[model samples]
Target chain A: MAHILVVDDDEIMRALLSGMLRHVGHTVVESDNGQGGLEQMNAYPAELVITDIFMPEMDGLEFLITLLEKHPDSKVIAISGGYKAVNACLSLQMAKALGATDIIAKPFHTAAVIRQVAYALQSKTIAYRRRAER
Target chain B: MNASQSEQIQNTEEGYPDFAKLTEMREELGDHFLLVMQHFQSGMLARPQKIRQAFQNNNPEQLALEGHSFKSLCRQLGLSQMETLSVTLESMGRSGQLDGAAPLIERLLAYGLQAHCELQKYCLACGKPSSVQ
Candidate 1:
């Protein structure tokens, strides 16, 4: 099981994601926002991070950019409910461009979360293997 | 949507918290559902103040941020009406259209309180701590 970091301003989302991650046998760390997420990583780095796009005290885009600058290979999953006047797909596309390994929209099913997390980790493994071959 | 429709969504006889979703979570997380929900509810209690402040200050960005967080929290607990309301409010903040945000924010607050009461009832029924704070 991999260690995962969860960063979201909403406490409920954090708790739900943490409980779900832990239930699946992975170690989970919680943070309220991007800054806290970075601090947690410094305290104990995680293999993957699931972060919300809109947050106070450091949004996910800045978090993703900074984390990648420090550790380019860090796996991330960006989530959002879409801002008003902004299409959800468009927002997720921005996340993908920013290097999110995967994206999950809000009001997601639990199964989807499991599937996406597993798939993201698998994709990372594949990328790592490809690099080793080269 | 009209006020009647909004009221209908909030006061549906089906109950406050979505049972099907909560049951699914309970099945997946087992006893941890109660613990997680308790923590979630406490966080929700603090949201109104931030939202009200943002609205008062006419900071659409801040209001949108609060709405964004609220939307996510409501989604987690399966509070569909609250989720919808939050999404609308968030959109207003994002688009800088604070025209009707006050009433909507107040409605969101009302639903939040209602949800909390429902959660307390659920906790009491399950023999867990109703007041997690």
Candidate 2:
């Protein structure tokens, strides 16, 4: 079991994601937006962070950028739903280029969320080892 | 495509939520269903104000940002009209076009309140939350 952070402006979305994570035996932290997410990390860093791309007063992109700059070991997974409506991949693509460890689109199923978490957790070990080597 | 197709896609009167999605979440949440929905209600309540504030501030990016999050919320809940309006708002914000946004914003408010009222009916069905705020 790992500690994870979920950042989204919508409370329901945060509740749903956190609930899913908790049910699977992982401890979860919730934040309303990117700014709050950073604050939560400073208060008590988590093993992984799953953030949404669009938010007010410090969006996921700014959050990801700042997080990586401050904590080089941080593992992040970005999410979004706007791409589907806008019919574009630019946001997710930019998230990848900005260094999200992985990405998941919104309206994801429970199985898919769990699968992504498992994969991200696996990478945690690899990240730690690589850092230890350095 | 055609006007009929557009109308069909934009139809908002179908319902407040996609019952199938609600059921899936209900199965997953068990006792927490009411609480989860209540949380949605409160968040949705605050949405229109924020949208209007963004519009008043002439911040298309903010509108887009709100739409981005709102779209996901409605998508999961199956709030068709709210979801459709949110998409249009997001696109308008992206293009920085304010024309006709006034009416759409009002429509967003209407749909949001309508969904809230409808959701309350279901929350009552949950047989919990004596005082669902």
Candidate 3:
């Protein structure tokens, strides 16, 4: 029920993620790369973001850092298939350090995606509630 | 899996593009499954040209991009063999090892064609027009 931003350089991935999110009743915004993702975020200001790690123009880690810097409250899910030159765990760890709320590896299942999104959104909601109480 | 991939795997013990997995997705996604398949089919049809153009130009960066994109698409669709091949091609491109990339690229293209055929078959089975070229 949240507005979600899905970013990936692959059209198939963008379509698939957005489709999945929309199927679950989330409003979805899609972008082809991180720059486009940043622009979309500026325009739409989604409650959650799901992004791929490796992309042209700007990759996921940089995007995560930039997003969090601009909107510290932004909830992000970093997804990557990883690189042969870099360890997969390391890629994910970097994403976490950069402020991703969750990480999903490539070859992920639909249930896992839904679960993570829900968890991230719930976490955001709880955090917002706590802040409002203060 | 595409028909060729299914056949390739059937000859062995595994099937590319796991129909069982896709079935689960279809059940969860309902009508959206058609949209997913349609988008995937379009990628399968359009990407080979981009890959070929990258090869013709001997552009490792372009090849790497295409390889990475192909790998992601294949992994999402459960095209295991093609995913593996794309990963290899992606690495080769990234590491500036383009000399041996031609053979792999050819194989990748073949797998794409096979997957496209499979998409056609799937559309037919579903009583819809083929979404792929």
Candidate 4:
């Protein structure tokens, strides 16, 4: 099980995602906003961060920028909803550019999320193993 | 335009050109989508002034909060169009480009309407009521 951080301004979405992650045997840390999420990342150091693109205090892109600056090895899963297609694509591209391992569109299924998270963790492990071998 | 031509136009413009995939995705996540849509519609109605005022005041914080909330709901519904627009608004809010956000906000509002209609069609097809109250 991976230690996951879920950051979103919406309490309901956070709760739902947390529940799903926990149900899949992953430990989840919740943050209501981007700043708090950043703080938690510094303090707790989760293996993965699933954050909504928009937020109060600090937006997801800002958080991502900071997260990458501080932790280059960080794995992020950027999520967006209620944005235009091109804009969402841009956000995803930005996240990928900044070091996010995967980007999932909003309104995603619990199964899909679980799969993505699992794949991310597995990929990280593979990369680590390869580096260690080198 | 004939029926097929109209369908093609609708598909191309909205970004989900594959009707079958869209329908399957909707069906696979119907309950979650409905819940998200309910919150989205209510949030829009409950905070129209707050949303508009945020844009007017160029308050990125307020816009970010509202956009984040809306974005979360959109994520749950898989409303790609709305989600993309929301991301732009979020970015604009982050950059303090309040003026630049208007067009994106308008696009988001339009996407919201389209999402509502699409949800209604899915609900009807699945014999579920469109009770997004």
True contacts kept of each: 0.71, 0.39, 0.63, 0.24
Model 1, DockQ value?
A: 0.60
CAPRI classification of candidate 1: medium
- Residue runs of model 1 more than 4 Å from their true location after superposition: A125-134, B1-15, B95-99, B127-129
> How do the residues A1-134 of candidate 4 rate in per-residue lDDT, one tens digit apiece?
99999998777677667766776678999999888988898999999999988665688889988887787677888887534334677877777776677888766766788789888876663235446899
Q: What is the C-alpha interface RMSD of model 4?
A: 5.9
Number of the predicted model whose TM-score against the real structure is largest: 3
Instruction: List the global CA lDDT of all models.
Output: 0.78, 0.77, 0.78, 0.67
Q: How accurate is candidate 2 locally (lDDT)?
A: 0.77
Residues A1-134, candidate 3, lDDT per residue (tens digit)?
99999998887888778878889899998898889989999887999999989877898899988888777789999898876576557899899877788899987788789889999998863235447899
CA shift of A21, model 1, Å: 1.3
TM-score of each: 0.81, 0.78, 0.86, 0.56
Order the candidates by DockQ, highest first. 1, 3, 2, 4
Provide the RMSD of all predictions against the true structure, rounded to 1 decimal: 3.4, 3.8, 4.8, 7.4
How accurately is candidate 3 docked according to DockQ? 0.56
lDDT of 3 by residue, B34-109 (tens): 7788887777767866877887898878877788778777877788887766766676677776765676567667
**What's the lDDT for residue B92 in model 2?**
77
Which regions in candidate 3 have their CA more than 4 angstroms from the true location? A125-134, B1-15
DockQ-best of 1 and 2: 1
Worst 10 residues of 3 chain B by lDDT: B6-15
Q: Residue A109 error for model 1, in Å?
A: 2.0
lDDT over C-alpha atoms for residue A111 of model 1: 63
The positional error of residue B36 in candidate 3, measured at the CA in angstroms, is: 1.4
